[model samples]
Target: MSAVLDVVLSSAFLAAVLRVSTPYLLAAFGGLVAERAGVSNIALEGQMLSAACTGALVAGYSGSVALGALCGVGVATLLGLLLAALRLELGADVIIAGIGLNLLASGGTAYAVFTLLDDKGGTSGLKSGSLPAVPLPGIDSIPLLGDVISGQNMVTWLAFLTAPVIAWLFYRARFGFHLRAVGEMPDAAASVGIPVRRVQYTGLALSGALAGLAGVFLSMGYVSFFVRDMTAGRGFIALAAVFLGGLRPWGVFLAALGFGAAEALAVQLGTLDVPPQLVSTIPYAMTLVALAVYAWRRRRQAGVEVAASV
Candidate 1:
């Protein structure tokens, strides 16, 4: 209990939670957009992994964060388009395509990194450039809040700001309407003369762009270099966040924060007297708990509806 309180009271722990959650937030948002558009984009893991390597490699060679991010987004989006083409045009199953893409990314990144820098591990040897960090000017003057809010990586701040923008886009914009229509009722949307495939493609592209940024943030902003499989299942966690949030943007944001806190707690606990094995299970335990609770509520709601109908 004291250890938990210590972590909660520590400013560094709060900051770690934000940092750990950043990739999840970005990836969850991407998954949310794609899922909302009915894409079932399980390939977010692959997309992020691919972008991490590409972003690191490009930034190392070019020495510019901007171009690195742009290239990363482009590569990841192309991968997304390819997945769409495979699933839509060639009749491939979405899950299969996603898994295949992940395998491809894992192998391809290893080979590319080895060829570029003779390292199968990652881009740690390369002089890769990182995205700039920015401090909130006035917020830094505050007491406890300043430590939590200020001096985050630029992409971290962007991820937070992007939530409202995406929400507004969904609630206000015509493109959002089209995407939602295509997602919710493809047959009806088609009947209305909406080119369903095109809209689906656009949705995936947007999702890919966001996932690419997450990858870029992982390598360029989070760590300043690429590592093999460094995403460490954050992509899958983002998918979990998508479901946990009921595909709502703000809901997913909160869920991501929870997972981040769990992760940060695990890190903190690792340094304490607790068993290492027990400490390592904290994050996964949190995931299981969240899912179990969600399942229970869903079943309860269905049972109530059936009872009322009877």
Candidate 2:
């Protein structure tokens, strides 16, 4: 109990949780956008990895984090557009195309990394410019809460703020209404001249941009260097968060935070007798538990609705 409390009470632990969760939060937001538009994007992993490597490579070589971020987001957005084009124009299945893109990204990113860094393993040795952390002005003067909130990466702050923006967009924005309309019933939406395809296309593009930002956060904010396959399937976890959150932005934020805390616990446990392998499973195990709970609640809600109707 003391050990756990020690870990929890440490300001560093809280900061680690925030940092670890940033990418997940960003990716989950992307998932929210994709699903809200009626197109379930499964290519999030590909987009993130592709953009991550590209962003890191650019930042390492050019020493311009901003330009690297643009390249990353642009590449990811283009990938999203390509998927949309494949689905909307070529009559391809979205899932299949997404899966194919993931496979392609694995190989493509590997090649890019090798070409840029002369190594297939990773680019951790590259002199990459990282995103700077912003210290809250006069925040340190406060006692407890200030320690937790101050000195976080600027991207982290932006990521937290993004949740409310997404929530607002879902409830208040005109685009949000169109997204729901197209997602719920494309035929109905199109009959009213809602331009369903255009909406989907735009939604996916936006999703890719968010995913790109997630990638940027991973390579440029969370760490100064890039590791091959560094995302380690967080994209899939974000998808789980999307479903677990019932596709709500704030809900996804909470879910992502849970996963991040689990990850932080795993890292903290590394100093203990726990096997490194077992400690690493904490995040994935939490994801499984979350999914189970989501399923149970969904079923319970459905049962309640049926009983009331009957």
Candidate 3:
């Protein structure tokens, strides 16, 4: 017990939390953006998986990390546009279309990997390098703070910055106002001459880009190689964070951070005399509990509204 507490209290644990939370933060914000645009991007999982695979393969073959990251993000943005088109042009159900995209990404990435590398596992055989880490010279000299913040992956720094950037976008930007207005009432927004469809399309593209960044981080920043389904369920977990955070930027940031902390704790506990299986389940279990609490709060709010109306 004391040992566990010590581990949790250490600066290393804080750093681990930031590292683990990077993908979650990015993906959750992606979902939040799409949701605010009145489109639920359930294909976040697919986007992350596809991006991870694409980034690794591109980097490995081209020997250019920048180009690889660009291609990966481009692919995800295209997927987002694809989702928007399916919904807007074909009148297809967004949820169903997103699910289809997810499935397609899962199968498509795996096939691409096997076809190119002849490996069923992943791009482990490739020599793809990792993204550069940012070393804060002066900051690194600080005791606990330096230990926690210095020498993190560039993606990790971007992940932390995204929270504030998104907040500014949501409240202080013109596009954000349009996005919110369109989401709240498309008919009204259109009546006022706002291009509803265009805004939605843009929002979804941004969402995909953010998720793609998360995916790239997994393969190119978290490690030098990609694994099949390396995203594991981070996209879905990030979606949960979006809702659990009340669909707000800062709220989503905290929610994602909390999830990251849980996962980090689980990893730390694994080194202890704990059951590996039980420790691994901690993050998922927390997700379930969070969902349950959110649902109950929503139901209670609904009941209160009904009573007030009555």
Q: What is the RMSD of candidate 3?
A: 0.8
Model 2, 222-260: lDDT tens digits are 887778788899888989999998888888999988888
The C-alpha lDDT values of all candidates are: 0.88, 0.88, 0.94
Model 2 lDDT, residue 80, Cα: 87
Model 1 ranges off by over 4 Å: none
Runs in model 2 with CA error above 4 Å?
none
Lowest summed lDDT across 10 adjacent residues in model 1 is found at: 1-10
TM-scores for candidates 1 onward, in order: 0.96, 0.96, 0.98
lDDT of 3 by residue, 1-310 (tens): 9999999999999999999999999999999999999999999999988888999999999999988888888889889999989998899999899899999998999899999999988999998888999999999999999999999999999999999999999999999999999889999999999999999999999999999999999999999888888888999999999999999999999999999999999999998999999999999999999999999999999999999999
* Model 1 residue 24 CA deviation in Å: 0.6
Clashing pairs in 1: none
Q: Name every residue pair that clashes in candidate 2.
A: none
Error of 3 at 226 (Å): 0.9
Best by TM-score: 3
Candidate number achieving the greatest lDDT relative to the actual structure: 3
* Model 3 TM-score on a 0 to 1 scale: 0.98
